[model samples]
Structure formats: structure tokens, C-alpha cells
Target chain A: MNINEIRNAARRNAGHVRRTPLLTSPFLDEIAGRQVYVKPECLQHTGSFKYRGAHNAISQLTTEQREFGVIAFSSGNHAQGIALAARQNQTPATIVMPSDAPQLKIDNTRALGAEVVLYDRESGDRDAIGAALAEERQLTLIKPFDNEAVIAGQGTIGLELANQAREEGIRNAQVLVPCGGGGLTAGVALALEHDAPDLTVHPVEPTGFDDVARSLHSDRIEANAQRTGSICDAIITPSPGQLTFPIMRRLCGAGIVVPDEDCLRAMAQAFTRLKLVIEPGGAIALAAALFHRHQIKGDAVIVVVSGGNVDAPVFTDALNRFA
Target chain B: MNINEIRNAARRNAGHVRRTPLLTSPFLDEIAGRQVYVKPECLQHTGSFKYRGAHNAISQLTTEQREFGVIAFSSGNHAQGIALAARQNQTPATIVMPSDAPQLKIDNTRALGAEVVLYDRESGDRDAIGAALAEERQLTLIKPFDNEAVIAGQGTIGLELANQAREEGIRNAQVLVPCGGGGLTAGVALALEHDAPDLTVHPVEPTGFDDVARSLHSDRIEANAQRTGSICDAIITPSPGQLTFPIMRRLCGAGIVVPDEDCLRAMAQAFTRLKLVIEPGGAIALAAALFHRHQIKGDAVIVVVSGGNVDAPVFTDALNRFA
Candidate 1:
């Protein structure tokens, strides 16, 4: 909600979350027709920025709360982030994931020492299951982004980015984020509002999953009509969260939606030029920065590549098609 | 030549170069059976560590020498590094590249504002050509590894690595470096000797092109029988440099040579686990750290991924086969 909360979250998340690099390349600059910087959160623990929020949320709990542990409903970056964050705090975690979710995500979450509760995607209500488990174990639910603590944690990235950008003499620019629930976007906007007001924040999403963007434009909460068909799956949430929507609507610029093709192309460019492995969902912000250059109004742009937990086949396909 | 030289190089390189992150992954640690930290120089400018040496060498040159210009004989990383460094310093650079070298490297060098003079790799004496060009233009030849300033530039990585290792509480570790003319290895070894003496340094090379290893073992420089056949071409110099070899001999531990298969596997691992794009040549140190775990000592191992400039086909093949 404020800079102080985000600053406190930074203190709690220190030594746990990685300070991902702000990567730059001349090739990317030429493509964008402007200076481009990438904050690669894919290099974060569990291969996403989700870890920052997860760790920060868990760190705020009381001693008894940590002992009883935490629970979450997800099967991707959020699942892994909670699993690692909980384990690191010596807290137990129960992740209620779809039975049909990718085996690798399930396995990786379990490997991170989480109690993985598999729910049938078609027949089971995951929220009910997670709620029941949390009640039984007295576990706190660490929402992916809606929770204040989580947003503050993700804002740590914004703090680091602001400081790093200033270090690079980037006094003013458009900061692009791959938005799903608008947690990162809101947190980044808040940090910039306090630290570097000259730099504006924009939420970029996949074409079909532009809920946050639509919500900002209409000055109201909006939901996506469809989410399953897009290749950019990581940031595919139903809509912006209750806590995150207000911040995003107040401080953010119009959202930039990029096609899956552009995300794939951005992935390939990141692979070959910057030597970074960015997943399609994670690469969407970069895609907008590169392909939607006409829409951006600045001499410089900074993009937060959200995550890199893509499957081998999908990654190979991206390279094969665009590299 | 010493820690002071490396310290000075870091000072000169402050704003001009990128201080690449020391990346770590749980998956990598699981594979190596130790706390593995990767110094991803692949993320450096020009997609390699050669930029450090190039910038350092250029910075130390007299104004007259810089105005007169500089030259180098390389078709890959060095050419690009020199080209970018020269451009940043407003110094004219002429890169004498082999005609058979990759077209991408040549074009990239030229794009960075370097004069590209291609010589026949099979017939034309590249040495003679480079010498002639340097003589006619009154250019200072920045040797790839043999020069003192260049080696000191590479040593800056060692200083950073030592500091990062301590930050992670890794006091004792084996630092594996992908060895070519031993510039990086020697630089890192010298830095570790002064800063983190408990961290032993090792030169990791491809099996057949183990010239530095052989030279170290025999107490004399030993040339590789063949260099053109190795996929690890970025680190396939004939032998260790005269300046670098002595430092490596005194400060480095026994060499660890891994197979080409291991290098490819390491590249895939880096891609999938660490979200890093590493070339086979650059992945050699990681390969040695992962596959040759038994040969290493201590509970921690640090590897410097030297570069990431592999062609797409080669990268795709690596992902297809090992990812």
C-alpha cells in the first residue's frame, strides 16, 4: 500500500530472493529503436517473480502461523514459489493443484518439500479443497498476488529496479510488466510513484488475457473471456485482484497487449542476443517493448520478464520457429 | 599481473562493463552434489567475457595509440568485444577475421563499427595479415590472452566471484574456468589467491584440446594437435599464453577436462534450470563442475560460463539432444 511496507518487505526478503539483473543489449536497442533494459525475474528462485511475494507473505506470519504452515491453489509459478518460500522458513505448505497439471510442476513443488494436494480439474473445486486443508491444518493462505504482503514483496523488485535504473542513468522511461493479477504492476507503480515518479509503469499482457488492461481502461474490474488458448500461459489469470486493481487503475498507464507470435519471437531474441531463457508469458512485456515500439513514448524502456518455467518442448519450439 | 592491476581494471571498467551475476540453482546443486554457483559471463556485453579484456586493454592505451587505432585477429568473441569496446572509446578498430568464420560474427563486428578484413583461414597467414594491417595503421595489437592488461581485465571476474562466493558463505570451493589460452583461468586464479585463498581454481577444457592442462602437467607450453574439430571453439587456443600460463601454474589446481557430450548437456541444464543461454564452449566449466564432481574438492564449486555466442542450429541441437 505504501513505500514503507514495500521497504519492510525488502528487508524481510533479503538473503532469500535473488536480486535479478537488469540486462541490456545493443541488438535489443536497435529493434526497439530506443534503449531497452530487461529485469530478468526468470532467474529468481522457482524460475519466477512469484517467489518474492511468497517469501514476503510467509515472513510476515506469527510464530504459530509459520508452525501450522500455509496453503495455496495453483500448479505453476505460484505453486513452486510458495513451496520454496515455505520450506525455507521451516513452514509446511500444502499446494492444491489440478491432477492434470504438468507433471514437472507438480514434481518440482513436491521436491521443494510441499504437501501437494491433487484435485481433479473437471470434477473438483480446488478452492474448497484448499480451504478445507487450510482449516484442518490452521494454515494461512498465501494468495499469489491479492494479499498486501505479497504485493509489497513483489514491490521489492520495483525498488531494486528503480535503484538499478538510476545507476544506469535512466532518469525517465516506461517500465513494462507482464500483468496477470496486477500485483507486480501495482507494486511497481507504487514504488516508482514514490522513488522515481518520472518513470511510468505499464502492464503488458497476452492478447486474449488482457483483463488488467481492460480494467484500467474502463475504470473498473474486468475479467478475461478466454485464457486457455494462448501460448503465454504463465500470466493467464481470470482478472485483476481486489487489492491490486485500485493501485493499478490509479497509477498505471494503458496496457499493451502483444500477440503470442511476438512473445515467441521475443523469447528467441532473448535467447540469442541477451543469452536469457524467457518463457512466452514472461517474454510478453519484452515482446511489447520490441514489437509495439510505435505505441511506447520514450527514449528508453524497461521490461520485467516475469518467469522462465516453460517445458523443454515448448522452449525448443520457440527457438525452432523464431531463432 | 597482480591484485592491484585487477583492482585497477575493475575501477576503469566500472561504468563501461557489466558485472554479471553469480547465478545459482537448486537443480544445478542437486546434479553436482554441492553448492554450485555459476558466474554467467555469457550475460556480459557482446555475450561474452572478452568484452572485459577488450575494454581494459583499450583503456590502458595512450591517447596517441588510441587515436592511431587498434587491431586484433579473431573471428568470434574477441572481434566483437574489441569492436564494441573500441566504439565506446571512440577508437578505430580493425578486426582481421578468418574468411571461414561464422557470417553472424563478422556482421556483428561490423555492426559494432569495426573494420572487418577477412583472410583465408586455410591459406592466408592471418598473423601476417594482422601484423601488416597493424603496422600500416600504427595500431596496437591487443592479443587475446597473452597481454597483461587483457588478463587483468579478465581477472576482474575473479574479484567479483570471490566476493559473491563469500556473500553466499562459500569460503572453500573449487572455481572451474573454461580454459583457452588460460587468460580467464589465470586472472581468476590470481584474484582468488589474494581475496579468497581457500577457493582453488581449475582450468576446464574439452578433452582433446587440453593444451593448458598438458602444459601445466609438463611444466612447458603444449599445443593441441587439432583445433578446428572441437565444438568448444571459443576456448580452443593452441596453448596457454606466456603471460597467463605462469600465473595459472602457480595459482591454479589440476585441470579438469570434460567431453563434448558433457558440455552440450551442461548447456541444456543451464537453459532449463538456471534460465540461462550458454554455448557449448562457455558451458565447459559447468560441465566439469557437474560431470567431474568426483575430481573436485570442497563442499562448494563455482563455474564461470565464459560465453554464449553459439549459432542457432547448434543451440537447437543441444536442446533437442539433452534438454
Candidate 2:
């Protein structure tokens, strides 16, 4: 997606996606020894940044596509995003969710007026089921992070962050973003690079699934089918997507890998000190900053907290283990 | 304090206190059949509305008084609020905390550069120790409630809520505020009554310790010395404060009582649906709206979530009980 197109998408969806606040923290700054601003998407609708993508994608659909409805395969924030977006657009939506997924998510998606089809992750094929349903019903398939509209939609967060920071008298600063399939990070990097080329953008990845870091070093896409289930479940993707990696490589500086324990510790700190309920994935970028991942130094920095959809038990366990 | 004085204090402390967002929930609206807006003071600095009163009290201190330092006795959000506000004002602060208070709170107060003096709740004389310290050190005592400056500071939330509702095109809405010593409820009620007299204000009290509610009905302060800690630790005050009860009686329309179990259920629902970390006391008004008192029918109704400084284990247990 072009930078101008992404900016227009951001403008188009401004009313739909929350203009999530950029909050400054003296406590976080005292720890990092720099001024820190956080773009809190954890407080976004559906409790994640995925709402922007889903809302933007649904808005861009043709009348025929809207009439036929939409389908997607996701067991988490993306599912809720699609469900809420479709509900707002008065379109029918079908979501294929793994049976073992958290019941809170399933209930939320269903509550948003979406039809949820459950498939056992151990034995059932979610993608195949979703694809079949879409084809059989002539519904449009809205890919979670791979489509151009989705990328452009996610890029709006970066644009807003840059503008907000500039308005806050931060002419130049480092921006940190957590990476899953690299869609959010790539979109943000592209937007920031085009709008504020002087600003440095850093991608933070979970340690066990640091495929993006490895890919940057090897100059190619790297995949890891195994070794999932990091503490940061929200961003535990097996590989970086083909479209996202190239964009990230062209726009971002370097990727940083942070341990799962650090993410949990950051999560607890955020909850206790900042009063923000952040999921492990959303805390990773702040964790990287807290642990000092890069050799570079700055007077100001921004961390993108991407989501807050953590199961109560899982969140408690993480807090107990780290706090 | 007069309503005009309280309004002036609120204006003076505007930058210091977060004009916390008033969030609308379609899901909550669907469930209650009324428009629900949540004023999330749970996201305030120090995780509570105590910061507002603390800031206001400290700002009014004389130069000599500030030099002698400030002293407060509490086992909850009050300690953190006093410590942070004192630090910001460049004054020394001494806090007397119960031995059984959460370690996180103790650490946070200490980190904010306050001298935390621990006393045994079972054996040690809290009031005597506090008085001795104040007299010996010549420190200014900042009471948690029962003070005009503090009550005025807490009233800022109401001012912001009224402004926020106006921005959202909502006029003459009903608002519910949880009452402990009645500082928050009284301050908010005074502000709302002054700015928008047509608006109705409801104060929610815990079922077992409904001293404020009883006092409002009887036109006199009441006591329940035997009552303590069934749940909602933040609002377990033994009696209503003399400074706040009269204001509540004058401005508040009615008082609503909510059960402990209902508070837990509201906390769980807030986590699952709105993705907010609200303490038991913070969820009381919402609990009242959801279960106990459903007679509040309006085009728009706002619930003030007072704080989010919950102990992790207690939070986990509450979630499990409700979920």
C-alpha cells in the first residue's frame, strides 16, 4: 500500500477506530532515563490494534461483497474485530475458531452478532473450513493481516503516533512496535518512514519466535513451524508473511528479540504502575526498552502497546510468576 | 466546602488530575437498556481517585507547612497518592501503613520517595502513632478524607464527566458514584449540581457498611465499628466523614446498596468485555446498575470507576469466583 493511500485510509476510519491516546509516564521515563510516550491500543475496541484493520477492510468492500458477507479464520482479537466491524456495517460474518480457544473470546465474538463455527485445533482444519464456507456461500474472505487494505488500516496507528508526538514537541524519537506476522510493524514502519523519515523505528519480537530477526540477518523469509506458545500468545506467529517482511526490511532498522519472562515482568509493571492491563505481546516493546535492547540512545521514545486481551487465569499466573 | 470553591480547586488541579475518559459501551447499553458511560478513574495516577484529593491538598499547603512535610495513615490508594503528590511538590512525606498491606503498594510508595512507617493493626495504636509523629516532626497532616481541599480535589472527576457528556451530546444524565467516606460522591455531586442541576446523582454503598447511605436517610452521620473487609477493601470505611456526609446529603438524589458478590461479577465482566482492570470498589456502581438497583432508566447514565489498585491474588480469586 502507498503511504498516501494509508493516510487516507486512516482518515476514512478515524471515526470508527478510536483515536487511542498517547500517554506520557514520568515513572516509565525515570526507569528508561528518557521521555517515554505510549500509544495505548490495548485500550482499543476489541482490545487490540486488529480493529483498525478489520474496520478498514470491511469499509473498503464493494456493495456485492457486503451483500454476500465476509468470512475469516481467527481465534482471538481478529475474530472480535471482524465480528464488530461486520456488525457495524450491517453485514453477516462467519468466524472459524479453534474449540480450545478461550471462551471469553468466543462469547464476545458471538455477542457481536457473528456466527461462530468451532473446530478442534487438534483434529480439525480451521483454514479449510473457513475457505470452504466462504466459497460455498460466495462470501468475501478478509485475511487477518495479509491484505493491502488491512495493512493500510494498521498503518494509521503509526501515522497518528507520529503526528501526536510531533504535537507533543517530540521532533525526533525512536518508535518500538511488537511484531507477530510483521503486518502491524511493517505498516507502522512504512507510515513513519514516509511521514517522519528522521524517526527511528524498531521491531520487537518474542525470543522463541524471533523469525523476523533471523530473516533480517539472512536477508530472506524464515519459518518456524514448531516452538510456539510463548508467554506472548497474541503475537506467537510461526513465520513472517511474504508481503510484510519485504516492507519491514525496507523501512525498519533492526528487530530485537526479548525473553518471555521479560514480557511478563513488563506486563506486571504496566498493571501495577501504569494501571494498564496489557497482554504479554503488548508489553514486549516496553520490555525491550526496559531491558535496553539497542545500542542507540535518545532523549525520547515511543512504545506501541498493541493489545490487552489476556485470559484472567493466564494473566494472574504471569503476574504471580513475575511480580 | 462551597460548590464554587470546589469548582475553583478543580480548575486549579486540572493539569494534575487526568481528565479520565468517559467510555461508552454498546454491550453494557444492550444489557441495561440504557446508555452507559464509564468514567474510568481506575486509570488515574496511583490507580485511584485519591490522587485528585492528594494533589489538591498538597497544592494548598503553605511554604512552611510543605517544609515540615506531610503525614497520612492508610493501607490503600491514599498512601501512594500522598507519596506521589508530595514528591511532585518537592516536599518530604511520611506514610504510616498497616503491616498487612500489599507489598506492591508499599514498594510503590517507597519508590516514590516516601518514608513508609509500618505499624501492626492488631497491637500498634495507629492514631496515637500518627499524632505523635505529626507533633514530633511538626508535619502537616493530610487526612484521606474529611478535609475541604481533598473533597474539592475529588470533585474534579465530576466536572470532567459533565464536560465529557456535553461533548458527547448528552445532557441531564444520571450518574452513579461509589461512596466510602463520601469524599468522591459528595465532590462529584456538588460539581454536577452546580454545573447541571437537572442531572441526578446516585451514590452506591457496600451492603454491610452503608454508613453513608444511612446517614443520608437519617440526616446524621452513622457508625458501624464492627464492620470490616467482607469485600471491596477500598470502600470499607467504618463511618461516613463529617466533612463529606453533609455535602452528599445536600446534593445526592439517592443511595444504592450493592452486594459483595455483585461487585466481583462486575469486575469479571469489565475484564472480559471492556478489557479494564477495575478493583472491587471501582466496580460497585456498575454492579449496582447490573444487579441490585435497576430502576435507573435514562438516555445516558455514567458510572464512576474509582480505582484499580487490586492485589493480584485477591483479583484472581474474585475472577474465579465470578467466572
> lDDT of candidate 2?
0.81
Candidate 2 all-Cα RMSD: 2.7
* Model 1 alpha-carbon miss at residue B314, Å: 1.2
Clashing pairs in 2: none
Off by over 4 Å in 1: A99-103, A118-124, B99-103, B120-124
lDDT per residue (tens digit) for residues B1-323 in model 2: 66777777877787677667766557777766777888888778888899999999998899999999999987778888999999999999999988877776788789888999999866888889999999999999988888888888898887887787777777777788888888888888888887777677888888888888888889888986544565676777778888888788788877888888888888887776566778888899988776754667567788999888877776777768775
Docking class of 1: high
Candidate 1 docks with a DockQ of 0.81
Q: Candidate 2: misplaced stretches above 4 Å? A: A23-36, A118-128, A194-198, A292-296, B1-7, B30-33, B119-126, B293-295
lDDT of each: 0.88, 0.81
